[model samples]
Target: MTNRAGRTGTLNEELLRKAATLQEALPYLRRFAGEVFVIKYGGHAMGDDTLAKAFAENIVLLKQVGIHPVIVHGGGPQIGRMLERLKIHSQFVDGLRVTDRETVDIVEMVLSGSINKQIVSAIQLAGGMAIGLSGKDGALIQARKLTRSKADPDSNIERILDLGFVGEPRHINPDIFNAIDLDAVIPVIAPIGVGKNGETFNINADSAAGAIASALGAAKLIMLTDVAGVLDKDGQLLPVLTPRDVLVLRGEGVITGGMIPKIETCLDAVRNGVGAATILDGRVENVILLETFTEHGVGTMIRRDDPADGEGG
Candidate 1:
């Protein structure tokens, strides 16, 4: 009888712990009710089937709890694989693919046709209504060609490199989002945009997501990357950061390479009226839930001068 009683006690303790977790999440659910969360889903997470399903479940749960989720996805690895299978050689300038006309077509196919629909289907299968969209749809993201300048090391002369069909978002139209029932539907967006001349441009997914988050005045902009958020010099994750902190880190060369642009995107989004922005590791299961509903968040959150805001520890 004592052994049975001990087993029952342990089972009850487990149940109580789960109940406590739910109780802790209740306040956050109330706080984020009817708020929009823009999620940029990419990196290694997209390639993993298990992580993808978990991501879909996370989105559905957020919607079921009255929070709207907008997803922007990237397909760099998939695009490269497609290009290779087709025997199409590609080149990159300053980490931006020099997308010629043919390459841009394939980019659209991979991004809008394959990847976008896959994400939508995942969400739908997870019991949520998901609508896939491109920036060209409803003129959502109006874009212009991106120009990059590189200096010659010998003469120190700057020259602009024309990356054909590679564009940056000039504007985002939030009316398209309003047309859908945000409460009942999730929007999965591809970063392909249309230029003023009616030319299709391949915009960076991070840039497009930032613009969309800013335009919608979203409560949170979450960027899911392979890294475990921003790390300190000793490789410890910085849980919370301000704009000034980010700038200092950049100035000290701690933030470099591709991370620079991602940090800049977060900074721009928060500065342009988004409530907060975060960079987290998507490789972990249920990372979104860990960041949103728990006291101990899993990433680096950047806010505007408000140290009191966001998750701690």
Candidate 2:
């Protein structure tokens, strides 16, 4: 009889803790109601079946609670795997894939055809209406070729490298989002754009999500990465940062390699009027919920300025 009583007590404690968590989330749910959250979902999280299902359920929960979510997903690993299977050689310049004409076709196939629909199907199976789209659909993102200059180590001279079919967003047309019923549908976007000459260009998913968030004036732009947000020199998460803080970190070299571009995307999105931008570890189960609904978020959040104007956590 004592063992049975103890088991019931433990179960009651767990139930109370769960209820407490929901109560804590109520304020955030009310605060962000009717706001838009643009999520850049990628990394290993998308490949894991359990994580993918949790992500879909989170999106559905957000919608059911009256917050709209727009997803921009990356497929670098998937694209590389496909290219390898096809025996196509590829290279990267400054971390941007140097996509040739043929390579761009494969990128499009993987991103728009397989990956996009996969996410949509996951969300639909989780009991949400999800529509998959590419930047070429409805002229969503107008892009221009991205050009990079590399410094020659010997002569200290900069030389331009042409990354064929690799493009950056020049403009974002958000009218396509209006056609969807935000109350019932989520949009899963593939980062393939159309150039001025009607050529298909492969866009970086982070950049595309930032541009879309800015154009939509979203309340938040959340980037799901593999790492635990931006780390300090001591390797601790910074939690909150301003654009100036990001620039200082970059200058100090604390932020390097691929992280620089991700930070730049967050800075750009916040400065361009997205309320705030976050970089969080997508590996955590229900990471989006923990970041959005809790008092202490799980990653670095970059804001345009100080949170003195009744915004930001």
Candidate 3:
């Protein structure tokens, strides 16, 4: 009986390995198959060497499969470290860096010029061709200074404080993006936008990526964060959610805190014509493939409220 059980276990292990191989190949077979995916890379995944290496490998595979993957990255941890080293006191106005002229200079150098190139180099070292870019290159993203604060919805108290040199994405030029022959080349984007004055301002990587996806008519937008996607009140992964479903959750108080804005962004992208918006945990190995290939995708997939979209599929 013991020998029989061992043989069965070996056969099961072989079958499982074959199944995983097939699952990984599905996304590759689909390839660029007329899909554009935007990925926002940040958080602890950026700090861990192993995770970063895994991220690079996954990106290379996406390119190999003919998928037009665009990368937008945040260097918050790097910026924080640099600031600390320079003894510059960091201040935030509603979660935005209060950038003065000096800070803006540092932000541009670290984000667009320095760290951007480093990421490109890493991808190349991983045998993936990559190009580093920013919003200013070829007028990719036009912007204007943002004045943000809590505003009264009742049209009573208008609180608009200058949020330094933060720029809101007014337009996205995907021409430079389309012009590239991205056979195995990836475009690493830094969240820096050009203003009417031709000045570069720090932009939020998440909002910038969402805007780019909408402009490019991307099939999907993926935001890689520390959280394990949207969870139910019981702390279980919700798996699938629609824009309306998110609204109901907000009302029922199932979603609150920092998750509110994140979910709101996901819903907005889904509503604005992107096929889907996914909030995934980058810490997972091969998460990109798991979400795109498997029947049960990883993370929370925020889809349109229109039932017709998935009922038949």
Best by lDDT: 1
Tens-digit lDDT track of model 2 for 221-281: 9999999999998999999888788878889989998898999898888878889999999
Q: Clashing pairs in model 2? A: none
Query: For model 2, what is the alpha-carbon lDDT of residue 276?
Result: 90
Ranking by lDDT: 1, 2, 3
All candidates' TM-scores? 0.97, 0.97, 0.89
Q: Give, for candidate 3, the lowest lDDT window spanning 10 residues.
A: 304-313
Residue 2 deviation, candidate 2, in Å? 8.4
Worst lDDT 10-window in candidate 1: 304-313
Q: Can you write out model 1's per-residue Cα lDDT over 86-194, one digit (the tens) per residue? A: 9999999878999999999999999999999999999999999999999999999999999999999999999889899999999898889879899888999999999
Model 2, poorest ten-residue lDDT window? Answer: 304-313
Please, what is the whole-model Cα lDDT of each candidate in the order they appear?
Answer: 0.93, 0.92, 0.82
